[model samples]
Target: MFARDSRLRQWLGQWLPKRPVTRRDSPATARGGQGDVDRVRRQYLESEQRFRALLESLPKVAVQGYDRDRRVIYWNEASTRLYGYSSDEAQGELLEDLIIPDAMRDGVIAAHRAWIHESVEIPAGELELRHQSGELVPVFSHHVMLNEHTDEPLMFCVDVDLSDQKRAHRDLEFATRFDRLTHLPNRQTFEADLDEVLDGCRRRGLGLALLYLDIDRFVEINDALGYEEGDRLLIELSRRLSEQLRATDLMSRVSGDEFVLAFPGVHREDDVMRVLHKVQEVFRRPFGLEGHKRSITASLGICLFPDNGAGARELIRNADVAKNQAKLEGRGGLRFFHQHLHDDLVRQHRLAESLERALDNNELFLHYQPQVSAASGRIENLEALLRWEPLPGQPVSPQEFIPVAERSGLIHRLGDWVMEETCRQRAQWRDAGVKLERIDINFSGRQMGRHDVFERLEAHLRRYRLGPREIGIELTENVLIEADARILEGLHSLHHRGFRIAIDDFGTGYSSLSYLKQFPVTSLKIDRSFVRDAPGQPEDRAIMEAAVFIGHRLGLEVVAEGVENAEQLALVRDIHCDLVQGFYFYRPMPADAIERLLVGGVQSLGSLSN
Candidate 1:
C-alpha cells in the first residue's frame, strides 16, 4: 500500500504483487480472486504505516530526506525535536540553513554533493551542528541514499544526538585529574603541568619559586570536627590561597590539607618572599570552622628552580623537606631550600639507606644518661639514649640520624631495637644487684600514633620480665599538644598501667595549655633554654618559677633540664625542682661505663655539686 503521495504509490506498485480479477468463466472463482486482491491491498497498507511509524518514533535519532537540491523533502518528529523545528517548518528548507553551522556549511555541502553525484559515500562522523535557536548541538550523523542511479535520487540522513556521551566523557576526564572537593588540579595534573611548566622555564631561562604548604595539626581539626567539615575547610582554604597568586602562577591540591604552588619569573629572594608573605596572610585571617571562628596557620617550604632541583619530582621532594623543616621548627613559618640543606638531605637519605641494614650489622647501640635529684644530688633513674656508628670513627649523631629514620619510615624498626637493647641493659643491671628506681625511654610523637602502640609497649615489657613501673616513656610537649584522640587514649592506657609519662623539652614549644593538661603526664622537663640563663637573668628566673609552680600544682614532678653548673643546680634546688639532667651530673655513656657508676654507688657529680 502506497502512501497518499502519487510518487510513493507509483514506487510501491512496482514492488507489490497484484491479483487481477476481470470477467471470468465462473462468478464464484471471480469473487474468490477479488477477496485475495483485497487482502493483499490491506497487508501492503499496514506495512507502509509500520514503516512510517518506525521512522517517526525515534526520540534521539532524527531522520531527514532530501532531493537532489539538498532541500528537506521529509522531516520526521525526531528531526523536529532535535533541531527545534516543526516538520512543517523544516520541509522545503535547505539542509545548510536548517542545521549546518556557519563554519561547517561549505564542507558539509561539498560532502553532500559528492555523495549525491559521484556515488562517493559521506563519512559517518561526529559534528557540531547548529540548532534552530543558534546553539550548537553535537551529533553523530550518517547518510542513506535511496533510489540511487535514478535521475531524482533522495538522500536520507540519520543523526544521533551525542551531547550526553560527550558530556559524560568530559566529566570522567575531569574527575581523573581534579580534586572533587575543591575542584582544583590534583597531584596527577599538578605533576604533569609541573613538567610542562618547567620545560617552558628552561626554554625561557626563567626562574620560579615552588612552595609546598601543609596545614599544621590538620589531623586534630579533622578528628575534632568531622570529614565533611574538613572538606569544607579545605575548599575555603583553596579559595583564599588562590586569591593570593598571580595569573601566571599555578596551584594544585596535592594531598589532604596540603597544597603545592609555583610562581614563575620569581628569581630573587625578594620576589620569593613577596609571594610567601601573601600566602602567609591567607592563614593570618581566621577561618570559620564548623560555624566557629578559629585561627589556622600553615608551614611553607620554598624551592627555587634550577637551584634547588632540576625536575618536578626533585622539586616536590625538596620542597616537602623544607616544609617539614618549617613544621619541625614550629609551624606557621617558612624555610628555603639551600644547597647546604639539600646536602644535609642527601646525607639523611644516605643514613636512612644505611639504617635499613644497621640492625643486622649491629651498627646501632644505646647509651645511658642519669637523671638525679636536684636537692640531694642522688641519682633517680637513667634516660636511655640511641647512638649510631655506620663505620669506624664515623659516628652519626642521633640529632641527624633520628630524623632521617623517622622520615624514611624506619623509625619503628629503630625504636624496636632501642627498646630491646634498653630492656636487656636494665635486666643486666638488675642481675648484678645494681639498683635503679626506673629508666625512662624517649618516645617519638610519630611512634605514639601507632594504633597498636599500647599492645606493643605491653608486649615489650612482658618480653623483658619488667613491669610498667620499671620502664617509663618521655614525650615532648609538642607531642602532647598535637596528640589526637587515638594517641592521647593510647597514652592514657599506658599511664593507667603505671607507666610514668614525662613531657620533655617543656616551655620551648607551642604547647597549648588546654591540650597539655589533658595528656596523661606525670612530669614536666623544663627546657634547657630557660635553665641556661635562669641562674643569672630575672626573665629566665620568672619563667622557671612559673613552670615549676604550674607543674607542682598539676601534681607533676617539675625537673629542670640542662643544669650544667653549680649555679643552675642551686637555683633549681631553690625552685624545688624534683630532678636534674645535664652534663653537670653525668654525660651519656656506654652501658658498661654507666653500670660501673651504678655498681660503685657513684650517684652524684660531687665536682659540680654546690
Candidate 2:
C-alpha cells in the first residue's frame, strides 16, 4: 500500500509546474533552494495521503462526486460497496442512468440542473436508490456543493443506508402499542383508536358502544396459581376474545385483567347487548392450564355514544363506572351506564374527602360490640368497630366509608389510628377495673401488605403498655388467602408473640378450606347472613353446624356473628357456638356504656331480655 501511495504521488507530481530557481550566487545558495522545493513536495504528498485515508475510513457512508454535466467524476470504495458496482464502473457514468430509479430519474436531473444553472443548493433527506443488482436501497443523502472560484460547480453526495435504523424504529413502535403478555393492543393504542373511531362516528352519524370488562377474583386466582399461570390465563383469554370479535370491533387490555372493547356502527342497544353477551360466554369454558382447570367469570359494563357522553374519555369513564357497579352487584353480570352512577361517583368523592379529615377532627371513634360465650353468656371479648360521625350531615356507615378509605389510600392511616385507639381504650378499661379476655380489632387488607405495619403495631403496643395477647387481629378470608410472603411472615411473628389471629366474615371469599391450614389463624367467625335465618332455613342451620364442626376439628374457636333474636341465639347455643355478637346482646355503644356494662358484671349483661 505504501509503495502504491508513493508511486501515485510521483505520477501526480510529474504534472505539477516547477518553480524557477534564482541565479545561484554560490553552491551553498543553490543547495538551499533545492531543499526548500523538496520540503514543499513532501508536505503536499503527506496532505494528499491524509485526505485519501479519511475517505477510506468512512466505510458506511458512500461518497460520489459529479460534474456540471451530471456525469460521475469520482467514486470512493464505499460507493462501490453500497451500490454493488466497482469504483471504475461507477466513475464516468451518469448518476441518473446508474443508480437513480426510473421514476426518480427525471426529478434527479431537474434538481441537478437547478443546482448547476440557478446555483440553488439541493436539500438533504432520505430517498431510495437502486443498487447494481436492481434492488431498492433506502439511504439518507446529504449534498455538498463546491465552486472554489471556478465556472463549473461540483456536487458531492454522501449517502448512509437506513435499513438497521428503520428496523429498530419499527420494533420500538410495535412494543409500545401491544401488551407483552397477551400481544393485544395496550391502553395507549386503545385510547388512540377510540379517539379516531369516535371522530368518525360523529361525522357519519353512527352510534358506538364501549364495553369494559374485569375478571372476577383474578387476584385470588393469581395468588393461588402463581404469576406464570396467571399470565398464561391472560394469553388464553385474549385469544378467545379476539376469536369472538367482529371486523369492526377492537379490543385492548387496559389493566391487569381488565379489557375494553369498542364496537362502532351499532344501530341499537340490542346490537351492543348481543356482543357483550357473547363476551360473557367466552368466560364460561374453563381455562386448561398446566393440568388444572380454572373457572373464570367476568363483569362487563356498557356505554353508548351520545347517551353516555360523546367524548372517548367520558365514555370510558362511564363504562368503568358501570363495570364496577356490575362487580358490586355480583360477577357474571352486565350493567349499562346511567345518570345515577354519576351521582354515586360524586357522593363517593365527597365521602372520600370527608374521611381524610375524620381522624384529625375527632369525628372518628370506635364502638365496642360484645361477643359473649354462648354457653355461659359471659362476655368474652369486645370487638372494636370503627364508626365515623363527620362535622355535618348524617354519619357514614363503615360499610360505606371503609371502601372509600381503601380506594383513597387513607386506610393505612385510619387503620393505624384505630389500632392505637383500641389498645389505649383497652388499657384505660383495665385500669378502671373493667376487664375481658382480649380486645379484638379488625385489620384492613391494606395494612397486612405493608411491611412496616409490624413496627407500627409494636410501637402502639408499647405506648399502651400492653402485651400482644391483649389484642386479637381479625382479618377477612380474602386477606388471609392473598397474603404475600412478607405479610405471612409478619402474621407468623405476631402469632408466635401470643397475638391470636381470627378470620372475620368467613365463607364469603375464596372459601378455600385450605386457607384454614395456610394462615396462622386460631378462630373463625361465621358471617351474619347464615345466622340471621338459621332456624327457619335448614340450609343455613346446616352451614352453621358444619362451620362449628370444622372449627372444632381444626381446634379453632367458632364465633357466630349477628344473632339478632332469641331464636338465633338459642340456635347458635344449641350448636355449641363459642361466642355470639349482635344487636340482640347490645348494640355497639360508646366507651362509657361499655365501661358501665363491664362494671355491672356478667349477670347484669345476662338479664338484658327485660
Candidate 3:
C-alpha cells in the first residue's frame, strides 16, 4: 500500500470497458433524427442505471464520477465517508485536488485524460490515495471512462478500502520472516532462503558453506546479568556479527547464543577458514554489556554444500554436530562436518535414549578392578567401573556410553546407582566375614551439579550401615580442576566425613598439582598413559617419580594405573608407589567373581602375575 507497494500499480492495469455517451447536440438530433437521438438517450439512461445498481451492491466502495475536465460530477455516500467529504462539497471539486496525493496528482491527471480522450481505461487494483484529513488510505480502485465517443466523456472510479488487508499482510510478514529482537532473518525464513540459494548452486555447479556458531558460556553470563540485559547483549552481538557478513551472505539467530550463517561460492577449506576467522575476530573484540566490556569466544561448525549435505536441514544438522564436537574440545575451536561425525552424533543420541531405561531394564552393572599394595602385594582398594550391555554378550564400552550419560544428564542417576550398589555389596561382604578395606566409585564433573549429591551418598551409606572409610570417591583430575565452589565445598564435607577422596587419572589435566592443593584429595592415581612408558621413557618415568614425591610430600597416597607388564610393575614398586592397578594382576570382574575370590582367601599378586 503506500508508495512502497511496487505491485499495486502493475496489478491495477486490467480491462474496463468504455461506454459511449448519448449527446442531444449530435448531428442526428439537429438533422431531423429525433427517434435515433431518443434511442441513444434511453441507452445512456439505462447504462447510468446499471452503474448505480453496481454501486448499490458495494456499499463500502467509494464511487466518484468526473467530467473531461477532471471535475467531480458524481460522488456517492461511500465516497463521502471514505474521503471525509460530503457529496455536495465534492461535486464541483477537481479529482486530483480532492483525493490524489500531491506527488501522484500529475500522473493521476494524465491517466484520467488518456482514458477520457485517447480511449484508454485505467483498470482496477490497489492504490494509496490521500484522504481529506491528509492521511494516506489504501484502496483497491477500478477506473472506467464513459461516453468515449462524445466530447463530454465522463470517468467513474470505484475504490474498496484495503487498509485492513495491508496491515494484516505487513504483520504476518514481520512475524514469520524476522526475529523479534535482532530483526535478523528467523530460522524458518533463513532455511527457505537457503533452499533457494541451494537450487541456484545446483544449477551453477557452485559450492557453499553453512556455519553454526555458538557463544561459549553464554548461559552463565546470561544468568549473571538479568534477562533484559541478556536480550540486549544478544541484540548487540547480532548487530556486530551482521556488520561482518557480506551483503550476499545470510545469517540467522536460530537459538539463544547460536547463529546459523550461509556462505555461497565457498569452494575450499581455506575459504571456509577465512570466513571463520572473521567470525572469530568479531568475538575477540569486547562487547558492551551493562556498562561493561566483556570478551567472549565462540565455536563454529562448518559443512560444505553438495559435500556434507544437499538440503538445508541436513547441512544445518551436520554443522551443529560439528559445533558440538568443537565445544567438547573447548572455546574458540572450529570443526568441519564429516560423515563419521554425523554418524557418531546419531549413535550418541540413540544411545542416550536407550540409556534412559538402562538401569530399570537391568542392562547396567559394575565390574570392580582391584588396587593392590605394591609393597605387600595385597589388595588395598577396589575401583568400581560401570559397564553396560544392552543385550546379552553385546557390551557397550564406557568410552562410548559414559559421555552419552553425561550429555543426557543420566550420569547423576547412574552415579547414585553405582554408590548404592557398591555400598550394598560391601554390606553383604561384611556379613560374610570378608574384609574389604575401601572401594572407590568414579565420578564425572557433571554428577557434582546435583544438589543432593552428598545427601544421596549419606543415604546409601546409612541404608547399608556402612562407614565412610569403606567408600571412596574417585574423580578425574579434570573434574576437580573445574570444580565450582559448591562442588568443592561438597567434596570437602565428604572428606571431613572420612569418605576417602581420590583424584583418579592424575597428571593428565591442566596443572594437576594446583588442583591437588585446591581440592581436598587423599590419593592420586597416575594416568595409564604416563604409567605405560614409565619404565623406558625417562621423561615419563621422571613425571611419575615427581608425582610420587609430590603426593607423599602432600601426605597423599599415589597409585599407578595400567601396570600390565613386569617391567612396568617393577618400576612402580621401585618408585615406592603406594598401590598398583592394572590387568597384570587381575582384570575388572563382576561382583560375583570378586565375592568368590575374596571369600576364598587373601589374593596373592605374585602367583596371579603373568
Candidate 1 positional error at 38, Å: 5.0
Candidate 3 residue-wise lDDT, 1-610, digit = tens: 1122324333322222224554558565578877765776677677667766666566688878888898998888888878999989998999889989999888887877666566566656688888999999999887655565888876667788887789999988998899888999899999999999999999999999899999898898878988888888788889888888887898999988899999999868789888888888787789878899988888889899999998999999999999998998988878988899988878888889888878889888889988888877677789899989886558898998888898988899899889888998888888888868988988788888788888898899999998988889988888877778888898898888888898888888887367677789999899999989877799999999999999999999999999887898899988989999988877899988887777764354553652
**For each candidate, how many residue pairs have backbone atoms clashing (under 3 Å)?**
1, 0, 2
Put down candidate 1 lDDT per residue, 258-356, tens digits, no spaces. Answer: 999998889798898788888988988899987899999899899999998888889988999889889988769689877777778788888788888
What does candidate 3 score on TM? 0.76
Q: After superposition, how far is residue 96 of candidate 1 from its true place, in Å?
A: 2.8
Task: Indicate whether candidate 1 or candidate 2 has the larger TM-score.
Answer: 2
Q: Global CA lDDT of candidate 2, please?
A: 0.83
Q: Each model's TM-score, in the order given?
A: 0.75, 0.77, 0.76
Error of 3 at 211 (Å): 1.8
Looking at candidate 3, the ten consecutive residues that score lowest on lDDT are 9-18
Clashes of 3: 2
